[model samples]
Target chain A: MAIDWGFALRIAGFGLLLVFSILALLIVITRVVTRFASKKGPEEKEKKEERE
Target chain B: MIDYQTGFTGLTYGHIILICVGLIFIYLAITKKWEPYELLPIGVGLILANMPYTGLLLTPEQAGGVPGVAGLLGIFLEFGLYKYTVLPLLIFLGLGAMTDFGPLLASPKGFVLGAAAQMGIFVAFFGALALGFWGIADFGIKEAACIGIIGGADGPTTIFLTAKLAPELMGITAVAAYSYMAMVAIIQPPIVRALISEKERKIYMKPQLRAVSQREKIIFPIAVMLIVILLVPRAAPLVGMFMFGNLLRESGVVDRLSDTAQGALINTITIVLMLCIGASMSAELVMRPETLMVLGLGLVAFAAGTAGGVLLGKLVSRLSKEPFNPILGAAGVSAVPMAARVAQHIGQKANPRNFLLMHAMGPNVAGVIGSAVIAGVFLGILG
Candidate 1:
């Protein structure tokens, strides 16, 4: 059977693009969630320090 | 007339060569301490499979005849690898249980670097196409796709994709992927150093990583599963099991299940999986010019991945305010702690005060996700 060069290349292009986009979305979600977590961390730290 | 049948009766020089190859793998695993858990079993399986007329593993001819007539190892291969795709996916579950995504959660940019390292996969894909198109090798798109994943440096992902796309090439591709993964320390440093200068390697950032909240840790796997699976439903089986394993570990309520998944379950699956992978490497299947080409392409893919990660690290470092050691980018090849450790070793050598392990780990783990996503894409397209 003959190889489909066009299909292979298309998969390569589309695959890389999808991987980056999905990972980019992940990075965004992680940053947003961590932002809230970091905000809460400071307040908790302050309360602990005041109690001490 | 007395008829004599012995293993030696059908043995050929090719079988002997494969036996020697198996011994070499065993030697490397034991003395060299190279992925001993996998290579050791695989080496033994290779020896067992290559012994002529042993009936330990049925030839394809025998397998095609009667279902009950197949050997024990043949049954394992048929059911475990081809039938259910159980072993590789189970290995992924164990990997998920063992992995800690805290570093990745702390530094999300590592995800980008992780994605960048997959450049090797695409590059090798095109390279394989060119080879096949030019009659250099007889690789169809499916076979090419299988060969390309060796660049991911993720063993289970490689096996999973190869099994789905090109079952014939599974043994050689698995060997190539794991071999490079085992030799990350040796293969990666030169490429990393060549890509990034001494100044970049010496660049040290603060070691303190913000603590990831338990809630965030718990949510991370779920969130990842939803996002990745939604984007590439083909990746659901591997990603779902991986996330399930992580949830068990992070849930704080299932320590027993988590422990079993990470320890006993993983160890048992690794032995069986590696043996099956090795046993599949019979001389008739493995002793071909195409196998050598696949091995060569695998090395190229690995080198390209390391280079891609390091190069992107340089780009990200220049853009970010914090001091970023580009050496950590080499960890994005997804060989787990080995790639990260190599980054740390190289960084420390450049500057004793520069510790890049945790930083490298962010991208290192991200590479795992990245490879899985890429594999999913290939399966979606080809499978």
Candidate 2:
């Protein structure tokens, strides 16, 4: 069988793009959710309450 | 005059060599404590499969003519791997259940390191193609892809991908993946040291991570599952089960089920999966030029992965205002806590104040998800 170098390169290139894109999306979601829902650590809570 | 048949008479040099190899694996597992969970069972299976006149490798149909069959490892190979590919995915489920996503959630940037480490996969993919292009080995693109995934430093991912694309290469790839995983302590330090300077290794960030809420923990797996699977639906079997397992752990609602998935279920699947992988390595199948090339390429992939992670680690460190150790990038190859532990070990060696374990884990677990995503990509394109 004739090896298709073009297709092989495409799989390598596109596959990586897809992996990066998906994980990047996960990171974005994580950052957004944590910003909204993450519980402030004790240190942060104490300082914020003192300021209030 | 009736005579009883014996395996001793049928045994050849190939069987003897494989038996010796199996003995070596057993010795390493027992004495050195090297991946004993996987190596011990695989060693026993290797010995059993290579024994002449043993029907352990025979399919039920192949052994039907015989009055009775004792060695039935072949059944696992037929159904668990080739036909259904259930065992590896189940192992992923158990792994997910056991994993704590806190580190990853606490430090989202680890996700990028995890993705960067996967560069080794494509490196090996292209390397295999080049070798084949030159008529050096009989590797097609599918075979190259299987060989390439070993760089992911994930045993189950390698098994899952290989079984899907090229079952013939499954045993070799699995053994390579686990063996390299066991050698993470040995493999990663040199690559990390070479790439990272002593000053960078000494860089210390605060040990305390931002507290992730119970709500955030619960939302993570569900969110990841939906986003990843929607984009790469082919990953459903792996990512779906992995996220489901994590949900069982993080949800705080199904302790009993989660306990079973993490403990009993994973242990059972590991035994069956490792043994079948060992049984597949008959001498004729393993003793080849291509096998040697694949092994070499696997090492390259692993090293490349570590390099890729560290390079990205350097870049991320440069960009961030906080101090970050590039050595943590080495953990992005996804050998689990071992790779993370190696980062911590190397960091402390450089400076006692450095505590990179929690930070390293962010990339460590992300490597798992990243590899699975790549596996899905391979399956989507090639399968």
Measured against the native two-chain assembly using Cα atoms, what DockQ does each of the candidate structures obtain, in the order listed?
0.62, 0.73
Global fold similarity of model 1 (TM-score): 0.96
Candidate 2 docking classification:
medium
- Pull out the clashing pairs in model 2: none
lDDT of 2 by residue, B1-383 (tens): 77877999988888898899899999999999999999999899889889887778986656674656635798888889988999999999999999888989999999999999999999999899889888999999999999999999999999999999998889889989999999999999999999999899899888888778988988999999999999988889889999999999999999999999999999999999999999989887887788889999999999999999999999999998878788888999999989999999999999998888999999999999999998998999899
TM-score of each: 0.96, 0.96
Q: Supply candidate 2's per-residue lDDT for B58.
A: 81
Model 2: residue B202 alpha-carbon error in angstroms: 1.1
- lDDT by residue (tens digit), candidate 1, B1-383: 88878888888888999999999999999999999998999999999999987787874445787656788778778778876788999999999999999989988889989999988887777777778888888887888888889999999999999988899899999999999999999899889878899888889888888888888888889999998999999999889989999999999999999999999999999998999999999999998899999998999899999999999999999998988888878899999989999999999999999777888899999999999999999888779
Instruction: Point out the worst 10-residue segment of candidate 1 chain B by lDDT.
Output: B59-68
